[model samples]
Target chain A: MEMTMCGIVGLFLKKEDLRPRLGDLLTDMLITMTDRGPDSAGIAIYGDEAPGLKMTIQSETPDETFAGLGDALTVAVGAPVPLRVADTHAVLILPEGTEAAARAFMTEKGIRVMGTGHAMEIFKEVGLPKDVAARFGVRGMGGSHGIGHTRMATESAVTTLGAHPFSTGDDQCLVHNGSLSNHNHLRRSLTQKGFPPSTENDTEVAACYISSRLAEGASLGEALEGTLDDLDGFFTFVVGTKTGFGVVRDPIACKPAVMAETDDYVAFGSEYRAFANLPGIEDARVWEPEPATVYFWER
Target chain B: MRTIDMATTPLRDLNSTLQAAAASGEGQWEIVNPKGSHAVAVGLDGPIAVTIKGSTGYYCAGMNKAAKIHVTGSVGPGVAENMMSGHVIIEGDASQYAGATGHGGLLVIKGNASSRCGISMKGIDIVVHGNIGHMSAFMAQSGNLVVLGDAGDALGDSLYEARLFVRGSVKSLGADCVEKEMRPEHVEILRDLLDRSGAEAKPEEFKRYGSARQLYNFHVDNAGAY
Candidate 1:
């Protein structure tokens, strides 16, 4: 009855050189929190973007779905669309300004887009954190910042799409550690507003809500602040954008959240152990994020 | 004193090692480099002492009895949860639900404790040196919760026979929780608790809060209150 529903981690590298170690460090943090959530795990990495739009997609049957998909998309779009496969997920790179066409093509092909952004690629699966990370080669990747989640599946099923790091907007994703009490009501409203959530996970509702706020030109901090008033739940959300990392907790602050900042980076975890092995953590300024407060860091 | 390095030893191995040592009558242990591991030194029943050198994750000393545990750094959620007896001390801040559902024992947080501290406590004595977050001691059945600093919203909601003391302001009190007069005996009890917990605050500077006994039993008059 007292089970913690999930674990979330985020890291923003202030020093550009540390970008290459983003996935490695995030994997360590994510795996360290295996005790908090054991059902499934996911990660969203914000690495360097290619010359055009990039969308990460996942399929249960990767072999049959991904084979020669890039060549077919290239012929359909009349431009080069390079595809790279990793386990059940693949990243498709499209020509500049061809996101809509590529998306339409993928939709016609019955592919599920996990996330779409110039710099972000999401990989998630239903398994332990370590296995999921290994299967996706997350540790070998590099990025400027990233967020990860291990879920215990309180509200929905434990499918690959039901995992955390739900994305509803370009270069935007969110990982949540608490359940939302008013998700059903909020989801209906969001769907009416043209930001329909693709999954039943409450975290997806939160992601769409923030994306809608950002679409209205609110800053990342302001959007996160809006959650304190608009959302009714006990949640600790860690969000990743193209250029920033942000965190916020509900008013009650029942879910655990700890943040550590050093000269080189800012790291967040549901517990201190997630970032204990990070370099310079012993000297990092560590503290708990206050209730209903928004903390964001940008390069 | 025995030293257990958690970096080399797995969490289960470390817990089993402590259990074996406690069974062998070892009176003291020094756990080095905990690195925020959960459930450290849990379910121990003996007059033993455990000093964790670094921060710990959730439920560090859950269901403990007769063991005096001290952590030099902050603790994750549910530290000393369901504790039956003995004392647990955290030199740094504590996460939510510290000492939740505790039946007995003393829990001391030298720094701030987050929300739901001592929630549903049955008979535990909790002393917090700094502030505590919202909804602390909710539906508490018995025992004492003394806060040297401020208390957040709904300090004691649906309380039952629990003695709550706060030196600073209370955001709000939940149903059945009311401010009570601090008699001489109350002051003495608080003084003893503060002294035992090594808190510097004076008992005379505190205000007592407890249940108002309005909704203790089923009654037609309490329908609106419920």
Candidate 2:
């Protein structure tokens, strides 16, 4: 019951002009779903990419922890690490191939790595979803695609890290709206396969599972299909890759999902009510996706 | 004619006024800017005619009685759920479980209906112009489900007495549900239902499917299969 009550929202833009409005559009959809999950909220935005690796890290004490952090990291990695702070989370654009070195450096310095990719930046916190989005200024961010989650927190404690939109692979992440009964068993197998979950949250296990499959040369659609056969329990997973987003639901489809596709964008929500305010929504082709089927759109 | 703009009036207020109109008796209402709000025009109990402008969220016209509700756009899940008596028409597609567990009503969907359409319906008459999803009419007790298009996997599993009619192909029939002989009475019923629902198909194009009555009573020998 805890897992089945979260709200998931995704928007993948097909037009470049709509890219700047992705975060603003998604924030409205996410806040409208505050009734579904109020324990925690998280958003993963695939914004414009530069020629470097971007890593988002979080800290409880930001001013003290972030001051002089970039210069020190730049010197340690022998490359410039430009950091942009957004409240509790900070995005660091590091030089190419410095992700592994920077991750280890952050671990030693006791900073939690939220996510790392060429474009993706994850921001999450434990509070009302509306407040969380405002604190991170999510509406001001821009991207081509993004996924957001408002968690009810049935299985784990309501903390900053125990939110949805778990990222395990580079330029990849996942947000879920249901619980996995077989997560404990799957976690063991996934850990052995070198995609160990960083959190006790069952959703992270599924995220790690996808990351592992993608690492083994599986496409996003194939990785989603694998979940239907291997994973147990109810889920509606909306995954994010470098270029696009994918959606898949468990065979039972206990969790509800609705999708809308227009010429400009493809939108996914836990319910149609989430899409009430989108532009050109009336002209979109709206329908509920079938169970155990994989739907993905790429640029 | 009364016009209620949902953009200004809250959903709770909209529903209350619609429901309160039952005491004032029959009237015509037009709701604009519905914007996919949940439970709009629900619990209405008069001979009112409500025409909603846009798509609606969950449970629109739920538990309705005597009112005629029409939506110009698609509907979310559980539309007309547990309806006692009314006429509900959707101009576009319907989400999962359209007319679920309705006791008595006439539901017409001009477009497709998703999974579990008319599940557990008691006495509702449902007609879909397009396809229905898997596990439809599951454990239904009594009703009539008519689909002009195909039905997904496991059409009417564990059914009892509810008559199923399909003009197109059915992927597979559930346990204890089989294609029965379409008699003259069924053809007449189908003809009237199609006419009333504004479906274009002929009654002879349909095939009837219903319960074998094997799963009705729990017998010691039929515990596993039934």
Candidate 3:
């Protein structure tokens, strides 16, 4: 398996004052774990919410795909749809009640939609995590919470589409560090349930699973707990909602996971080494997350 | 005192320096800013003391013949694995499969140890002041595992020969593993282990577990357990 199989990191800020530094801190943590996986990397930031909606899209040829995209959306929405470009991904600020039309417009133009929400913006590409992060200026972006993955690609190809932080619902994303033995079967059932995963990536099936659960009114903790029974394989999932960060590991927990929480933030890493540079980490309550347990933090 | 700063020096230099230390060399060495690096002081055959000021990643002190190594922070997977003869202490928790397949040594963890703490251990003496995770001591052939707190699921599954001492309740026992009477001799061994590891639990309050030796010969009827 050429795998994006290791190095998962997340940071959830409890102190609102640290929001501006979330990306910088998470970037440092992500870069520190470079040795775990180097095939591809991705990040999902629950940053400041725009007035209407934020839809992030990625393309192989950004110069042609992104040019005039904002102007075209503005004409279609009958309002200015502000755009921000970072590397191969671009975020479009859509006007209220225009998501369906904009979705159709982008689809007709054959655009790859990454995620949609007011606060969540995702960036992923096929490269080393440090280089990917630098290309997107992840160090300068500000957010209240974010999760990142550096994949090694064991079960699938090392393509941008196969990278993690899969977003199946607005403001919700997931990063995984293990493979699923029953992803094909699970994906079939999920597709039947209207949560068809867009990629062959196993992690995307899990992301859709969470989104499907939340759409059915299951709480974040309940959705995470559901994973233990329905999913079969080794996994350490760090999920992010608009205002929440949740974690769960398989009952076996063969894949490594560690967490540290302080008065300011809650953090997760596949190893303690990822937390070495966080401020006040020496005083943080660092511990190993228990197997088959769901740990959630909301601000 | 010799101080090695890993932030400025690569891990190869640190390990080579320690591995090259003369067997007669007896002095104190300190490592700073380990930043969760792996194999910090592996394959040491000297008589010296090294203190790591921070936490470490995988295989902190593997195949150690001599040299006492201590860590002030938690460690990742397989800490002190296959140690020959020495003392390795972790002030914080240890990740998975610590001290696996060791020939001889004493591994002490003051905090909890994750899954399979001493799987397939040969002759290492491990005393954890905190709880140990699931499937620990599985198929362990020899040596002793002492836990002060509870053990997770399937303790000593398919075990062999290794003696297990737990002061707290066991979640469940694995196949062919059973609780044994803590005879005076067992208590003496436990006492010695507690004393050496500086753990303060009373030997009288503990229970000993070992293999039933039913699967030793691998009969067809016992094949299911394997």
Candidate 4:
């Protein structure tokens, strides 16, 4: 009933050279949660891609299609973005100035786009770490702070959309483990709050719920704490932004989350192996987050 | 017969020696003073008896095939992860996720075992003489998990294809989990398993816990709850 492993990797690099290490470090971190998820893998990387904000474009296939209007998307985004079309995914990296227009244009074009501070690249095809890593080319260009998902495919169908690191309409994304018993109610509430719901996933509802609160000028910590009062369920989620990260466990705390902190960086995961995988942290002091406690760290 | 003093031997050298001993078809092997070392007797597949004199670390007898392993002290996470077949007897407390995803084997923990014991177990018999932590036998595919002591909260959460026996109080049941009537057949099985493990408790004292068949196959009715 409960998902065991969840992970988040954030690094404030002493030097720019340390950024590349995030790939192998994230690979090691994500692989440790293999028991939690064996179906697909995805990562959201935020590095030197663009100084300004980036937008997330989500699309599906068959009935909800968007691949037909590639030319319109290119002009609207104002960039000849590489469109990696899977059965369900079609993405374009919009520049900073065009983010709002791109969001609106994609909305009219029937493509769901949200602005996120972190550049998210999600790849989900069945394979081992090497094959998955090759698809996103994460072998060389790992970023400073990234979150990964390895899903066991319990609640929702195993698809790239169900893959985590769900982005809000702004520069925030979230990855979650554990089921939310009250996702339906939360989704209904979020829709009433003027937030458009995309996936049928409860995690997406949670992402939007938090994002809507943040849009009301709430701090990340305030939004998280506020959700605890309203949202009900068992979930341990790690939400990431460009300059900050936050982790919150459900009130019941059925899920597991361990954190290791050093002077330079912070790492948290459902298991100890993720912390063990980070370099320059051969002896990072690790501890588990208490139940109902929300932790926030800003770089 | 063979004996390796782990106090002076590294795990790499000692594991090789134990493998050699098992390949030699030695009836008995002893690891004296195996203090907090990890991966002891892992993947050993032979008709051999191993006795680890002290505490061990994670995956102590992981993926074991035929050998019978005895740990004299506490064991860390995943004491027998994915073990194929064998007997692992723990004389002391066990840490988290003990016997996780094991396919086949008999895990006898004389002392308490921590959470997620026998999680996703396919075909195994785990006998815990002391209290068990939360989520014991979670999502177990097929196996017999016998607990002689009180079980912590959420026993047998989302359980499947597993038979569970607990002699003491159960804190709570997980999603789709329930308490079943302990039939005479279950009592017989428990008796036999306890006899084999040399446990003193009687089978009649134990209660049975298992899946309620609610969240077995994902129906819309049981969505989000699991």
Q: Residue B46 CA error for candidate 4 (Å)?
A: 15
Model 4, position B92, has a per-residue lDDT of 75
Model 2, span A1-299: residue lDDT tens? 24758899999999999988999999999998898999889999999896798899999999999999999998878899899999999999989878889988998999999998998999999999999999999999999999999988766678888887899988898999888889899989999999999777888999999999999999888999999999998899999999979999988776889999999999999988889999999999998898899999988
- The C-alpha RMSD of each candidate to the native structure, in angstroms, is 3.3, 1.9, 1.9, 10.9
What would the TM-scores of all predictions be? 0.90, 0.97, 0.97, 0.58
Q: What lDDT does model 2 reach?
A: 0.91
Candidate 1 residue spans exceeding 4 A from truth? A1-4, A154-156, B10-13, B20-26, B217-226
Q: Give DockQ for candidates 1 onward, in order.
A: 0.67, 0.80, 0.79, 0.05
Docking class of 3: medium
For candidate 2 chain B, which ten residues in a row score worst on lDDT?
A: B217-226
Better of 2 and 4 by DockQ: 2
Candidate 3's DockQ: 0.79
Q: What share of the true interface contacts does each candidate keep?
A: 0.80, 0.80, 0.75, 0.00
lDDT of 1 at B184: 98
Error of 2 at A63 (Å): 2.1
Best by DockQ: 2
Question: Order of candidates by lDDT, top first?
Answer: 2, 3, 1, 4
How high is the TM-score of chain B in model 4? 0.93
Tens digit of per-residue lDDT, candidate 4, span B157-191: 99997998998999888888888998889889899
At residue A260, give the lDDT of candidate 4.
61
Model 1, residue B91: distance off in Å is 1.0
lDDT of 4 by residue, A1-299 (tens): 23444333433333456677776677777766666677777676666655444454555442346545556666767765445443444445555576667668766866655335535444444445445656556656567677767766755566666666687655577878777778888788789998866878877888898889888988889888876887777788888776667888775565656666776567777655455546655445444564566888766
Q: How accurate is candidate 3 locally (lDDT)?
A: 0.91
